[model samples]
Target: MRRLKWVSIVAVGLLISLSGCKIVKNPDPDSAGQADANLTDEARMAALARDIWDTDVLPTVAEHLVPIDDLRVSLAQNEQAAGQSHGLRPEGEANPWNFAVSGSGSIVEANTTSRAAKLQVDTTGDGAADVTVQLGPVIRGTAIRDAMPFLIFTDFRDQIEFAKLAGGLNAMAHERLSLPEGDIIGRTVSFEGVFTYRDLASAPEVVPTALSFEAPE
Candidate 1:
């Protein structure tokens, strides 16, 4: 009887030990549902910006770009009409017309530190520049995303994330679109981009989504 009792106790202990050694699978090693949960705020914002730029902004801008000259003419004729025609107007703001513009020009000057450049473009191929195109300084602002008529505050979780998304897109533009400092000087360049008109009377500065250059042909 004593031997039988001892044997039974040993069998229970062995079973417990075996059970402890058994491999337990993690419920979320792939982290599918929890992927965003682990991301930092900046990382999440950047990811969202990249996704939106790829899926919404890029295609929309490409399809809807207005010629820089035409945009200028419209603004000159009537700023309010131009803003409403091609862009979404905030309830009461008069500046920052959200629109896309495209043109080719010679780089008159460049400021790489500021990430901006001035272009002298003659849209009609006239001898003189019809306009001085400001290439950027796109290092900040929610202008790009805000300019998209389809996108609104409700599209994002909050203003903070929305602001971060803009910053992310700006960073991406500087990374992917900007030219080397002196390389663009005197080079003929073509660009398609979005801009916010701070003042209709002043030259429009563009934040380029597509830019290319080569020796003038």
Candidate 2:
């Protein structure tokens, strides 16, 4: 009777321990506590830009940002001026508003399967950009990452489908982008309008840095 009781107790304990294996293996050992480490200066700045793009940019400009009727034109009454152009500075007038975006890219968070990226917008015309917008930080399996889910809105027809607009937006949110702020969080900004650019580096000047600001249709 003693042997049988001891065997039964051991079997129960083993089963309990085995049941926890799933829980123990759920965490990625390489990723444990890594989220808190101080990213290198380059890494931190890059991350800030990315956060702006993911958290700020994509949602704002996607089809739903502005009313279906609003996005019809390039500019809007509420939109802010981009400043003067670089070349024909009108003699004394401050140089043309030359803004550009460069080094745009993305980063994927392994654990949550979320993605973050940087959207560079320069208005000064100089190679380096003045303002930056981070957008996304989009979670995996969300409407943005996968299929489009219908949401009630004023003009769903004009609104760019969430998935369809992701490619161009992602192209804008490249990995190597930069921003003036070392730490970018809790900033109210906006980006709209369709500006053309040749490549990430040589794009147009002083283009708005949307900073994840939604599109104003």
Candidate 3:
């Protein structure tokens, strides 16, 4: 009788332990749902630029596009306010205007070393350019990425990932949007792009998000 009672108690304990193991192996519905949500967030971040460009940028461009010449004037008039109102602040630092601009021009010169091609655009479409547009070969700075209202530092897992995302966007622009050295010379081009401003006299070196060109016939 004593032996039988001991055997029964051991069997019950073993069954309980096995059941606990199964529960751990197969998560509950709520846990599974949370995991799925996390994955979705990560996927959303992976396509951050495309997602924001469609949802946020296009609409903003339609509504708020400042002509390149007009923007330069504004920056000259009130550098601080222009930057604060139009530009996105860097993750932790404060700076002057980082803004978007749109214009059309002919490529006056191409500088491969600086990776910046110069465009002669007449904001008024007169005989002369109101401002010179600098197109990038190496698009640096955080102006464009930070300018998007939808993005926040916390949206990324860490600063490293955020930097990678920014660099990836730059690479995408270079690959898909930038014109070849031979193709850009003497060509007419139109662009919408972002720049960071430190002073009025400095030229706006733009990293174009949208660009279209017409080759000389």
Candidate 4:
């Protein structure tokens, strides 16, 4: 935990310093090639959001969620290339193929019962909140299995509770949750992250808009 805190501070300093430079963050991957006149640091942040979503978040999700029949998933744009590698030849060669890249990682869950639905989002890979996650709670019953559902964000402290969950290993795996307030306190959630080379390649699509900025209260 101490190490994570230091990392967050270093990242913040770097971001602040970069804000003064000429380069700005780009929002869309497609827009990356185009040259802009002069964009502010805020614009750069938006651009950063876009690139992060496409390159990091989106692909990660797609690789995990997208399904493949064989133990090995092959990613290809056409069947002829896929057929050359794998025994099976896809009927429609135009469509892309999915091949196994690596074994799956741990699963993490994110969920909320808070009505506000806001969370402290911390990016920059520091493993700490640049701002804070004020999202609602996904409460579990006081007892184990059998319990009544309740609102998670009924109080302000729920923010701290929510952060504990979001900052967990699940968020590292790029998984978020939507759950009843009662269940957030105790319950295991599933999550995964993946990286693939193609656009249609089954992987998580980065939502730059969601991850673009530090959540400020």
Candidate 5:
């Protein structure tokens, strides 16, 4: 019993010595605060999107834009040729070709039921849908990013960043957009934006950076 008591005392002493030698200080609060202050990937991309939207992105879109009416004809004749002329795609990449286009049309249909909403535009004035304009808080695809010549994929850290930038740009555009509260069928609208499709046979899904609803005249 005495030996056990002596061993217990030695064990306690050793533990106390070890604890004294290894000081476990709390982590520096400032370091943790600084890390928290750092911009998240989404914030970073959104800032980048805002920085470039007017100065770089808009100008680039204008430079590459083809009229929807003309694009339809071009696609009908030779999609590859049209894409080569008006679209942007990496030389050897399998990504879909992206194009900037402008058109004014009547809103024949507004599918606002889905979060991935779309407006069917009748550009021809014949009361049929010519193109689809994406109205998104939830947008799909990276058409804008792929279309911009200046926003090279290699310029970003990786595919995730690039994709987020696309989303940021889409969100930025959505921020500027002001949709009409009531029914908008037959309302005249004009838009300039980017789009992508797997084949020329498919209608363009336009992600409008600029969308203007014409005042009834």
Candidate 6:
């Protein structure tokens, strides 16, 4: 009789636990951390850019930085294989593969005259740029926007709004980038940047999230 009573109590406790559980059907991880719906479009764009750059971009790159040399070698073999190994392209995305890369190299060229200012980095020590990093009042390409796997195209109202978000992110990059006040020519600089390349043949055009120069020696 005592054993039966104990079993009944255990059964009751199990039933209570089951009653408290709620099943979430088809939960989307990306949607869980989306921008505030109440925010204005302009404000939402800015917020998304900050969230992508500061919260997602930096930490994700820091954890999975691909070396320049390895990238070139892998990319030569095959684009799909290279992307899977060293970078990311959203599932079923026909877009260029986006990569997070870090390397120290000399700035062979600086085009500060143009509003779309850029530094040509020679990471291979060969006198030519292995990659071009945009430091911009006008940054080109959708590298930052593309790097964000969470910001799905369908999430935005339309394609035009998506383009605006890209523009906002470029503006954010320009605002954050700090270059040496003096001549930056031939300066040894280290950077953590993101770039997307459609073709395997052309050099990467990167958008840096973290860039710093080594003090002149």
Model 1 segments more than 4 A misplaced: 1-29, 89-95, 113-138, 178-182
User: Which residue pairs come into collision in candidate 5?
Assistant: none
lDDT of 4 by residue, 97-137 (tens): 32312222211222243543333222323443222222323
Which lDDT tens digits does candidate 1 get at residues 1-217?
Answer: 9999999999999999998796887678568657878887778878877777878878888877888878878888997888777764333474466787888866655555555545665555555555454445455455577666665667778878777777777766655665554556667778887777777555556667888887554
lDDT of 5 by residue, 1-217 (tens): 9999999999999998998796787666679566545768788898889999999988989998889899888888897888788878754557778888999999999987788889999998898987899998788888887777778878888988888898999998777788877788889999999988677667778999899897765
* Model 6 poorest 10 in a row by lDDT: 27-36
State residue 99's C-alpha deviation in candidate 3, in Å: 1.1
State each candidate's clash count: 0, 49, 2, 43, 0, 0
Indicate the TM-score of model 4. Answer: 0.21
After superposing candidate 5 on the true structure, give the runs of residues whose Cα lies further than 4 Å from its correct spot.
Answer: 1-37
lDDT of 3 by residue, 1-217 (tens): 9999999999999998998784546566578566556554434444665656656755655455677777766777787766655655555556445677888776655555566545655445455554455455456766666666666779677987677666655544554555554645566778887777767655667767678888668
| Global lDDT of each candidate | 0.69, 0.34, 0.64, 0.32, 0.85, 0.81
lDDT of 6 by residue, 1-217 (tens): 9999999999999999999999778645457344365456777787777767778767776776798788888888887888888786655757668898888899999998799899998998988887888988888988777777777889889987788788888888788888888888888989887888767668888888888998876
After superposing candidate 6, which stretches have Cα over 4 Å from the reference? 1-43
- By TM-score, the better pick of 1 and 2 is 1
* Candidate no. 1 TM-score: 0.72
TM-score of 5: 0.78
lDDT of 3 at 58: 53
Candidate 6 local Cα displacement, residue 125, angstroms:
0.9
Clashes of 3: 2
- Which residue pairs in model 3 clash with each other? 83-97, 115-137
Write the residue-wise lDDT of candidate 2 on 37-83 in tens digits. Answer: 53443343344335555454444435323321232122232212222
Query: Against the true structure, what is every candidate's RMSD?
Result: 5.0, 18.4, 5.4, 25.0, 6.1, 12.2
Candidate 4, position 24, lDDT: 66
Error of 2 at 213 (Å): 24
Better of 1 and 4 by lDDT: 1
Between candidates 2 and 5, name the one with more favorable lDDT.
Answer: 5
